[model samples]
Target: MIELEGLTKRYGEKVAVNHLTFTVRPGVVTGFLGPNGAGKSTTMRMLLGLDHPTAGDVRIDGRHYEQIRHPLKYIGALLDAKAMHGGRSAFNHLLCLAQSNGIPKSRVAEVLDTVGLTAVARKKAKGFSLGMGQRLGIAGALLGDPQILMFDEPVNGLDPEGIHWIRNLMKGLAAQGRTVFVSSHLMSEMALTADHLVVIGQGRLLADTSMADFIRENSRSYVRLRSPQQERLRDVLGQAGVPAVEAGSGILEVDGARSELIGELAAEHHLVLHELSPQQASLEEAFMQLTAESVEYHAHSDTGPPDTNGWAGGTGTEAVSGGGWGEQWAREQRKRKAGG
Candidate 1:
């Protein structure tokens, strides 16, 4: 298990990571999520003792990383895929790491095979593609056969196959009772991979909860209704003490009312209902809603001309993608409404 308590880090006048406290438990994949420059990398560095925290402490298995002898045997991390020596062959690279760490040479081949990089074992790392590089990095992390593993953006530049492989690998590791903590900007991947989520914005902890709970708490739930007499239906819904908003022509978004209640009201009013569906907000939308103000950088258009298409490619677009950003979001939404 990894436990961070009141962790804080600063660079000159800027605070990189604020006073944050969270625990990543074992036997599950814990996702570390945030926008760019949210101090995720900095936090990981502090955990690994690469950078000293300004305050607070981080502990792995009840001990600080620096205090633990043979740290690699206890914790394995792939902080940077490109941190390896480019001139060295994949096998040679792991061999050197093993030799220095007292790991047997045979273990190097075992890890290389585990990452499916045995075919390119003798190839120079400089010639490997981004996916191959990631595989090699993962191989090195597993070289020690550690019980705790941390990966930062393992699928950043991977193809679909590579991404799938990593997802399964992480899940498999967690299933084996290992602690798997991975950081990524891809909410979609995290939704499928993580059992729990730790979200931060501007270096402050925004949430630390189960993935389902986070989405359920952050997303707005509404009942979607459509009728031929839309205006009358809207009035009926409003009179029933439910908040209603016009989602589109002949469609109303109703909140604070269950589907059965809405249906009963419609039947009582003799409304010609064309459609009645419930809509729950997506995780991407919930994330945007929660962190919209905390976003560190904001882009502005020049010439004072309004960019009408700005929202089209920005957060708005992300919110509309639905399952693309996180399948767990959509699944949870379905489960909530289906419970009715």
Candidate 2:
């Protein structure tokens, strides 16, 4: 297990990572997610002892990363796939890492085969494609056959087949009871790959939960209805005490209502229904919902204003926009007081 308790990091006047406290357990794939400039890479570097923490502590098992001799034998990391010397051959690169960590030269060949770089085992790193370079990096991480594995964007530069291969590889490792923690920008891939999630935003721990629970808590589920008789359908729904929101494209959205119930209602009213289906918000939607304010970098999009209902809520500064919960409550009070 990897444990971090109140882990923090600072760069001059800026706090790169806040008091992050979490445990990465074995036998599961834990995905790390964050928006741009969220200090995800900084936290990972601190875990590997590549960067110093300003305060707090992290441990590999019970020992600090620096205190663990032959640390690779305990935890293997692929933080940067291109961090190797370009002049060295795949085999030579693994060989050097093994030598430094007191791992046997024979293990180098084993790992090269494990990552399917045996054909290019003798090729120089500089001659390798991006995909090949990623494979080489994965080979080095697996060299020690450690109990804990950490990967940052392991599928970067990989083709579909390579992505599938790497996905199965991580799951297989976790199935063997190893701790598998990875970070990725691909939400769809992360949804399929991760069983657990550690989400951070703006250097603060936003959420630490299972993938299922996180999505469920952070997203909305609704039933969509469409019919040939729009006005009649709306009246039928309203009379039945079901709130049907008139959505765009001549559709109605009913929250907290089952599709079966909506269908039955349409049938009872003799309405010719064209469409009725349930929609659940996706992982990408949930992640963005939770991290809206924490997003450090902003890009102007033509998209409309965000739906601030679900888990996103609103920032404290949203009072300026009359969106914050406290501001809304105060506004309600003044209206009641002034008889507006």
Candidate 3:
């Protein structure tokens, strides 16, 4: 297990990681989540002893990174997939790491095979594709058969098959009772891989919980119903004291209700139910809802950037945000459908 006690870091006058305290237990994949410049990389650097903490303590498997004997054998990490020397071959690259850590040379080949880089063991690192580089990095991390593994965006530049391979590899590691902590921006992939999560923002901790609980707390849950008789269904639901919003295309969305309740109501009203399903929010939606305020960078919509200076021959009104944006988009779609 990895333990942090009041973990903190500073760069000059800026605080990168605040007084954060958390424990990453074994037997599960823990996802570290944060927006850009949220100090996730800094935190990981501190964990590996690459950066000294200003005022705090972090331990990897009951000991500090520098204090551990043969550190790679205890904890292995892949912070940057392309950090290797381009002049060296894939086998030489992993062999160098193994040699430094006092790991057997035979273990190097085992890891190369484990990451599916055995075929290209003699290939130069510079000639390797992004996916191959990522695999080589993973191979180095596995060279010592460490009990703890950490990866930062392990699936970067990987195709669908490579992504699938890495996903199962991490899962398999955790299944063997290893501590796996990974940092990734891909919420969809994290949703499938991680059982627990630690979310941070602006160098401060936001949440540390299970994937299911995080989504449950940060996102809204509603029941979606589709029926041919939407008008009658709306009236029936209104009389039944259940407020439902029309969600376009004969669909009604009801909040604070369950599928069983809606199904019973529909049957009693003699309304023909085409579809009735509970809509639990997705991980992306939940992550956005929780970190919307902490986001340091915001991109413009495809409509274009904000019109700061008045432009010649331009409409006076600009599209609104939030609900207004969607409303305006719907208006534009209607106009197009009418050939305006």
**Best candidate, lDDT:** 1
Steric clashes per prediction: 1, 0, 0
Question: Could you arrange the candidates by lDDT from highest to lowest?
Answer: 1, 2, 3
- Assess each prediction's global lDDT (C-alpha) against the native: 0.82, 0.82, 0.81
Off by over 4 Å in 3: 293-340
- Full ranking by TM-score: 3, 2, 1
In TM-score terms, which candidate is top? Answer: 3
Candidate 2 matches the true fold with a TM-score of 0.84
* Alpha carbon lDDT at 113, candidate 3: 89
lDDT of 2 by residue, 170-267 (tens): 99999999999998766688899999999886578988999999999987788988888989988988898888998899999998748888889899
Least accurate stretch of 10 residues (summed lDDT) in model 1?
A: 296-305
Clashing residue pairs in candidate 3 (N, C-alpha, C atoms within 3 angstroms): none
180-289 per-residue lDDT for model 3 (tens digits): 99998667889999999998765778789998899888777899999999999888888888888998888899986478887998999899999998887778667765
How high is each candidate's TM-score?
A: 0.83, 0.84, 0.85
TM-score of 1: 0.83
